[model samples]
Target: MAITSANQLELLQTAEAVAREKMIDPDLVVQAMEESLARAAKSRYGAEMDIRVSIDRKTGRATFTRVRTVVEDDMVENHLAELTVAQARDYLENPEVGAEIIDEVPPVEMGRIAAQSAKQVILQKVREAERDRQYEEFKDRAGTIINGVVKREEYGNVIVDVGRGEGILRRNEKIGRESYRPNDRIRCYIKDVRREVRGPQIFLSRTDPQFMAELFKMEVPEIYDGIIDIKAVARDPGSRAKIAVISYDGSIDPVGACVGMRGSRVQAVVNELQGEKIDIIPWNDDAPTFLVNALQPAEVSKVVLDEEAERIEVVVPDEQLSLAIGRRGQNVRLASQLTGLDIDILTEAEESERRQKEFAARTSLFMEALDLDEFFAQLLVSEGFTNLEEVAYVEVDELLVIDGVDEDTAGELQARARDYLEAANKKALEEARELGVEDSLVAFDGLTPQMVLALAKDGVKTLEDFATCADWELAGGWTTENGERKKDDGVLEPFDVSLEEAQNLVMTARIMLGWVDPTELEAEAEEEAAEESSEDATEETEA
Candidate 1:
């Protein structure tokens, strides 16, 4: 087929029109043709074949020129079969051994295969350019929420048509127990956007943590403006969630703002979560207080902190124990996680017992001592001075400083105070030793002989130490090794050192020394002392 200039101009015009319709630059189209023609020439002729295509914008005429190497031998099959130097000189005035000669290969009409190959090349390049453009467009949108229409459902997954491309809402990412029909308009978080072989593949999610955060951002203006911050969040999707919040501005209440008036704001967020309950707890730096608040509807009376064990014992009324513990311990469990502490719930009874123990420990007396009616005795109990030595060490002025005690009483008490204090301390040491209290008297520095003797006379000997001594034995006083009164004098001391005092002193010593503790020792001591005094009075009257 002989190509006329008119035919060539018509082909170029057709190429130009196709390039414009495809939105491909004219220069690029020309470049693509040149590369295609070069490839086609090489395949037909050999690697030695070189070709270039030229398009004239005015006439739209396209032409092809082929260049050949001037070689000495015909050893190369291609490039005009390598013309000899003598033959090459006939065409050129000066010819180098490696120089190439240019020639025009009368435009060979592209065969069907060549035309198809060129068309494929143009299409491939155009498609790649479009993909690059799309990838650049969507890459910036990753991690953002986008509104899209549900285009179709395939195998339980929804394909959303985002304006620029398509996004997949995987079955797992969709809210469970909810259904979406085709063309349903839904908002989803764009987890990722990447270029794939087909086009930009956008991955959308509705269950991501960012989804919850975004909901808060939409519903709470303060959060969007950065006035309030969400400290931490834990969620059981479609069920419940706990979000801790704080504010940079001291005056702002982060929780209240997030909750909104009548909970309208938070309710809106809850609705989006498909009725998932949201707990907006105020973030607290104090772990104990924070945990107390975390377990809502449960009032806490006290919190025993065990920092080393990372555990806390929370005491609530008997009626509130169940509430504090929640359904299957859910309340406490979540509270523990939120506060990063292990929580144990205690009822009122347990708490009372604990308080009694703590009081005994502080007073250095048995819980029984608390029952004592004597003002001075009770004062000693309150001060944790169970034995005479503790009292002896207490300054008279100091005693006077105690609430309800005047200087006159403190002075009078101090006058007869030493003997009583010594006796009380001795009784405490013996009781502590008998009870096998660990480290008993090992660290006690101010014990006196009088206190030890007095403690023994009260039957607070080893036998009485471990077990509660009878009132008669304590009042009558214990026997010495030779069966005589334990006291130096046959007559028991006239001063008032009641059996209750003896008991209280022993218990207090035990506590101060980190020994075993029962209950209010002072109360029981007073009762025993009163009974003994009554019995003694009756015996004297009979005599």
Candidate 2:
């Protein structure tokens, strides 16, 4: 409809209706209508003129005006919108340089094309306002479950009609066996709410581990109240899942609370998950204890934890080995995920056999490398001497403390070890030089002669080459050799330097070459200090 004084009330009513339908403030809609009228007035008043429109909130009367800002003659840029103070004085008395002079203009009759243009502008504004409203409503709602109806399926992805806006549930985020039809009510975790050019796109997920955790929080009051905490959750989607819980209160039992009265609480979660098995285990601070709890139903006889490697060797009865491994290693895999440890399952008989093999191998290694007799080699093995390097590095007093080894024999053993290492290093040094290793790299503290040879063979011969190497590259990682990358089957030759040692060696080389400025380190330290201060302030506010 054309905008005129007679229909101005109708325009206000239309804005109110649009705002009500879009769930936006009416003031925003009225402002949008005013802008649309201003754009249409520009077509009649010449586009170069600055036209504006305002509508009375109570009377719904529209006013059209042309605005000009007074400026000095030298400061005026656009002649249509800016007038010099001398020229503005003719219209108003004593006009200041910053004064705004507005002249009332007769309202123009809206043509058909002008009405179309105005409609387009109003719709665009309404759509933008709706997007902003949706973004504000859903942005902070991420990680919470929202119930929606399945609106339609687009290429196997379900578009859900959430109350305020639509959300997309990708096929991969849905459970393996679950399917939905149009109008089917579903609940999903808000994985992300991202603002796009078209609108805000909400992504939903039902298979996320946090989704299960949120479900438990909804069903269990203790979890919602903070008395019990869900420490970790691992899910197999439609098959099985496990969650670890701990109680802050000494008297409260977290597992029993999560289980509810006669498994009613857990059963609710299970039903929501489409009958997926749920194991709500109690969390433990100790690593071994946690692993034992994570690998439930299959008793673990013993657990050998290698903390540095983040691995656990679990020994179970022979009959329980298959059970501990589960169908296709699912049980142990889930346990590993739950406890954040790499689990190696072993039966009692297998552990014993492996122990015997390792003992014999160590004995053989000592006897061959140290040139010791069988009895002496066996004695060294019993004393926990595995390799020639250990014997070479140990203190003479430690060797003396061993049975049948007096001071003289200890001294002799030490001398032999030193001589063997020196001879081997000398041989490696010659080999490194033959491979064209630079003197600077060979002089670096952490790069042994063997490491030097390895670097030279890989074309990393100079100090600059070593400086450019990352710690993972200098330490241990997969390397492509002979047209193939190294596999994890224990046949690759890993670098000998540790990550810390490699970093030190690289920094030392860079410092020697003056490649790094000391001021950069100072700036980095200051940045870290500032970050820590900010984090402390945030934590204090939260507390």
Candidate 3:
């Protein structure tokens, strides 16, 4: 085809048609047409020449031109595309080193092969523009719910036509028993929107916990209006789930609001979730209290929480134990997820047995370490004396508070406890030195003799080694691997070193070695305090 007056307006019509069909900007299609024409012109003109084409938006007239840049004589690598500054007088009055000289040229008569190549270039550019438009439209819709019509299923994954673009519902993200046919209306959560090489992918999910929360928000007026907030959600996908909600308005009960009249609101969510059961519980700031509510229908006898470890123990009646754990541990597992804590459920009898075992163990430790009889050790353990260090350093008045203990007896007990601790510390120091522990590490404050021996055994002998250690490495931490939490043994954890104490000890060692500057730390602390104060003032003003 040739560029003629009869087909001058055809380019704009084609661009607009392509843009409207693809839901993209018309200017992008026009630019793509221009580049395709330029590429075809380059094939007809000398390949070494810089042939450019521009299409008029108003008239659709295509203009072809060849450009040669004026350059220094030594920089003229391509004579067809570049002109030396001294040899450019024919086209310019004064050609500078970086000036461009342009001349009009006739458009190329695109042959069959050239027209096909131009068509491919235009299609590629249009496809890229379509992808960009799709990504832009859906990226902010992530974490939201969308309603779409199922287009088809490929390899167990359902593809839905989400209005302007297509979204994918992977097999694992579908409710286990839920299946869809072509053209079926479906609702799903927009789990993520990703830009891939092929196109922008919209990932939809029905198994996400947030999907349930969004369903409640849609079904319940109180949640939609922010009178009640969904604090947490845990789903077992097509089986069961737990949702924690808190009401800002005291007159409204969060759980009752979520349940609605005759369980209307929650039932709507459950129906959408393929008949999955939902337990709507009132939210509490206190973790143990919240956990108790999460594990509903099973009364708790006692609750023991380890805040640092994010662990909880729930003691229930023997009969309620089975109910608390549910079928195959689903109840407690969902409760653990809802509370963000690891849970251990024990029956009352089991808890009592465990307590008795702990008491006997502590009594035995006191009996052997303090050289006391079982009766004396039992008294000490009953009075909350768990270790020899507490007995050795405790005030005589505290020992006197125990039964049948006079001032002389307290004195003798303290003397014996101190003598045993001293002997143990001396032996630990000897063993640590034998393991190549340096005096600098031993002299560091906050670390006991036993802690030093532990570090030495773990190959952290020198002060530098101690300074380089991570806080978690010295405090024993938990790690999640493949959805299960595993415990990482810390070298000094047996000595009861908390993470904060470990960090402080390491920082002190670093300061002594001049590896870190104290002034910079102080400056950072001051900056953080200032930022916190500013934020508090802003919040107070808003309140």
Instruction: Report the number of the highest-lDDT candidate.
Output: 3
- Clashes per candidate (backbone, < 3 Å): 29, 0, 0
Writing each residue's lDDT as its tens digit, candidate 1 over 96-148 gives 78776777665656667876777687667666665666678779988778899
> What's the TM-score of every candidate structure?
0.50, 0.88, 0.94
Per-residue lDDT, model 1, residue 171, is 90
lDDT of the candidates, in the order given: 0.68, 0.87, 0.93
**Model 3 ranges off by over 4 Å:** 369-371, 434-437, 531-543
Q: Who wins the TM-score comparison?
A: 3
Which of candidates 1 and 2 reaches a greater lDDT? 2
lDDT of 1: 0.68
Report the candidate with higher lDDT, 1 versus 3. Answer: 3
lDDT of 3: 0.93
Rank candidates by TM-score, best first. 3, 2, 1
